[model samples]
Every structure is written in structure tokens, then in C-alpha cells.
Target: MKNWIKHIVLGLNYLKSKNLIHRDVKPQNMLVANNVIFKLCDFGICGTLKDSISSTHLGSMRYLPPERLGNICSYGTRSDMWALGMSLLEVSQGYLPLSSESIMSFMSHMKNDWQPDIPTTLSQQTRDLISILLERDVNQRPRYYNDILSMSSMTTLEQNPSEDERNLIENILKSLPIPTPE
Candidate 1:
């Protein structure tokens, strides 16, 4: 888990350093060649730092940030962080945090500031990182890649996690409150 997160943070930082925001980051865009190796792909909706907030809705609905849903808010790299948070949740749980019936329903949920219930099985450190990454205020999110990489939990993932680590991850996934279909 740590190693997987490390690679993801590294890739995210690389993209931020290049002033690029991968507007569409989802499980589908993340290709896992092996248990320990993964790659982030699909730059179709990527935008430069200088690009203005898009009026057109883009990216996968499940991964879309709250600010993108008709709010007057302007988004930046932190928007990617929101997507990263969702991606992490997907990787850890094998499913999206929010599985709405439609894009409009998803957007409505975001507008209402609805957030997924954090899994109790996650380590305090991991939960803390996710909380900050998924904060409603984009300005409060970690700006630089190093900020995220510097996280104690993320740094630990640079190497393979032990069996105990896998157990911890599984516990966390199990703790999540599964969303029921309406």
C-alpha cells in the first residue's frame, strides 16, 4: 500500500511540477501492470496551469471535484488532488467512494458538500492525509507534490507493505459504509 501510494504521489508531483493538471484521473486511467507497478494515463482533458477554469464539465463524474459543479469557484492543481483522493479510495476499496445514479446526482451531492464516510480500519496517518486532500476548500489542500510526499503515510509506501499492511488496508476497506442504490 505504501509503495503504491508513493508511486502515485511521485507521479502526481511530476505532473504538478510540469504545471499540468490531469483533469481526468480515475481507476480506469491508472494502469497497474503488476501488484507493485502502476502508471497514470489518459491526458485527454489535461490542462495547463495558466488555463482558465473550464465552463464545460469534464472528466469522469465519480472523480470530479466539488468546485467543478456549477460553483463560481476556480480550480487548480488541488482539483487533481480531489481526483487523486478518489483514485486512492478506488485503489484501496476496489470501488468508487460515491456511485451515483447519474452525473447530475453526483454533481448535486458535491454541491451539498457530501463526502464519503472514512473507513475506520485506516491508519490515523492515512486518514489524516485523505481528509486534507479531500477538504472542501481547494486553497487548503497541499499545493506542492512534496507536501503530499512528505506525509508520513505516503513516505512509508515507498517500499512494499508487509502482510500486516495488507491486512490494515483490507480492514479499512471493510470499514467503509457502502452506498446503497436508491
Candidate 2:
């Protein structure tokens, strides 16, 4: 999970440096190989950043940040950070964090004080990182990928997946049905 986060942040850094915003930053768009390397794909909805905000709405409903939900007219990397936080939460808990049945309910839930009950097994560092990433106020979120990756705790994590995590990832991968070419 730690390595996965690092790889993702690295990818985000690269994309952001190029003035490209990956509007869709979710677990589904990420590929993990042998629980070692991670690659981000699916840039179909990506946009070029003139300053830092994009007014267009183009990302998964489940993974979008509150700002992207029209709480504001525009959003930037902070929006992607929110999705990354959700993706990490899903990975840690083995399920999507939010239970809202629709967009309206989801936005309502986000507007209120909504916090994921992170498993106790996860480290405090991980929790801290997610907390900042999931901050309701975009201003509080890490502005750039490196802002997150530069954390000492994040950089010091071991580059290994425990047996349970490996098994869980393998099972999830196996259960996903591959689509045939058209």
C-alpha cells in the first residue's frame, strides 16, 4: 500500500509538472504489478492546466472531491488528491469508503463531517496522510504530489507487501473479469 501510494504520487508529480490534470484519479485507472510497481493510466478525461483550475466536471462520481462536485466552480490537483485518498481508503479497507446511494447524498455526506473509520492495523502515518488528502477544504490539501511524497514517514516505509495484502490483491485481481477486444 505504501509503495502504491508513492508510485501514484510520483505519477501525479510527473503529470502536474507537464501542466496536465488527470481528472480521473482512481484505483481503477491504476495497475499494480507483482505488488511492486504501479502505473497510472486512463487519461481520457485529462485537461491542460492554464493556471490550476478546471471548471469542467469529468471524473468518477464515487471518487470525485467535493470541489469537483460544484462546491466550487473550479478545482485542481487538490481534487485529484481527494480521489487518491478515497482510493487508498478503499485499498486499506477492502471496500469503497462512502455509502451514499447517489450524487446528491454523496455531496451531502461530504459537506457534513464524514470520516472513514480507518482500520486500526494501519499506521498513524498512513492515517495522517489520508486525513490531509481527504480534507474538506481544498486549501488544506497538499497542493502538489511532492508535497505529500516528501513526508518523512512516507519516504521511510518499507518496500514490501505483507502476505495478507498480497493475497487480497491477488484475489481482487482474479475476480475482475477481463474484457474481450471488440
The lDDT for every candidate, in the order shown, is 0.70, 0.82
Give the TM-scores of the predictions, in the order they appear.
0.78, 0.88
| Candidate 1 segments whose C-alpha is farther than 4 A from its true place | 51-57, 164-182
Kindly give the stretch of ten consecutive residues in candidate 1 with the minimal lDDT sum.
48-57
* lDDT of each residue in 80-157, candidate 1, tens digit only: 788888776776665676674576777788878687676777778777777887887777888766888887766555
RMSD of each predicted structure: 6.3, 2.3
User: Which residue pairs come into collision in candidate 1?
Assistant: 2-157, 3-157
* Model 2 lDDT per residue over 1-182, tens place: 67788889999889998999898988889988874678999999998887887767788888887766665747588899999999989888878876535767877777666776777888898888888888888899998788888898777867786565577678878879999999
The top-ranked prediction according to lDDT is 2
Backbone clash count, each prediction separately: 2, 0
